[model samples]
Target: MAFTETTARLTDQGVMAMLTSAVQAAGASGQPQCIVIVDGSGVVLASFRMTGSRYLSLKSATAKARTAASIGAPTHTLPDHAKAALAAATGGDVTGLKGGLPIRSGGVLLGGIGVGSGSGEQDETVARAALAAIGADDI
Candidate 1:
C-alpha cells in the first residue's frame, strides 16, 4: 500500500508576493483591505490589515481564508442557505463571503487568500489579483 504522497505548498516568498499584489489591487480600488492567507490545513500563513481598513473586517477575512483552504474552493461558492449554518457550526472560523479564493498551482491545492473591508466585488478583485500575481489557477 502506498502511504506517502508528494504535496505542493506555498513558500514564504510566494506568500509575500501575493500579499504585495493584494495590497496593490486594494489600493487601486481606493479601498484599504484586510487580507488573510491560509494553508490547506486551515492554518494562517500571513495576514495584513492595510491602513484605514476596518478592523472588524480582519475577522471575516480570516474566516474566509480558512473556509477556502479547508474546502479547496471559493467561499462564495457556498450555498446561501448553508452560509449561516456553516459559520455557526464552525464558530465563525469558516464563512460564505465572496472574497475567499482557493490558491492552486498546476491543479495542486496550495492554500487560500481572502480580502475584506470593501464591497464583495472589490474584495474578490483583490484576492483574484493576488492569485494571478502568483500564477495560481483560477476558480
Candidate 2:
C-alpha cells in the first residue's frame, strides 16, 4: 500500500462539509467535542476541536480514527471481535471503544472518523450523525 500525506493535502470538500455539519450539530447539543478523520493509512486528514473541548479529547479521537482505519473495523466492534491474532498483528493497540467508525463510499473504504468529548455514547452519536450526513456507510 502507498502512503499519502494528508497535511494540507486536498480532499473531497463535500466530505469536509459533512464533517463540519456534524461537529456543529454536536456543539448545538451544548457539548464540546474533538473530531478527527484519518485516511486508510492512518494519516490525519482533517481535525477539529470545539472550544472548551477537553484536552485529552484530541488524543482519544486520534486513537479511535487510527484504530478504525488501520483495522477496517469500527471501534464499537472491538470487544466482541477480539482475536489474539489481530492483537499480535496490531501490537496490541486496537481499541473497540465505541466511537470509531470507518467511512465507506460506494462499498469502498474512504477513511475513518472518530469523535471524542461529552461522553463515549455522545461521541458515537456525533460521529454517526456526521457519517449519515455524508450518506457514508459505517464499517
Report the number of the highest-lDDT candidate: 1
- Tens-place lDDT per residue, model 2, 27-100, is 78888888988887788888889889998878778878888877777887776657445556766455666688
Worst 10 residues of 1 by lDDT: 63-72
Q: Which stretches of candidate 2 lie over 4 Å from their true place?
A: 1-10, 80-93
Clashing pairs in 2: none
TM-score of each: 0.97, 0.78
Summing lDDT over every window of 10 consecutive residues in candidate 2, give the lowest-scoring window: 5-14
- Model 1: per-residue lDDT, tens digit, 1-139? 9999989999999999999999999998899999999999988999999999999999999998988888889899998999999899989998998999999999998988899999999999999999998899979
Candidate 1's TM-score reads 0.97
Task: Estimate candidate 2's alpha-carbon lDDT, on a 0 to 1 scale.
Answer: 0.76
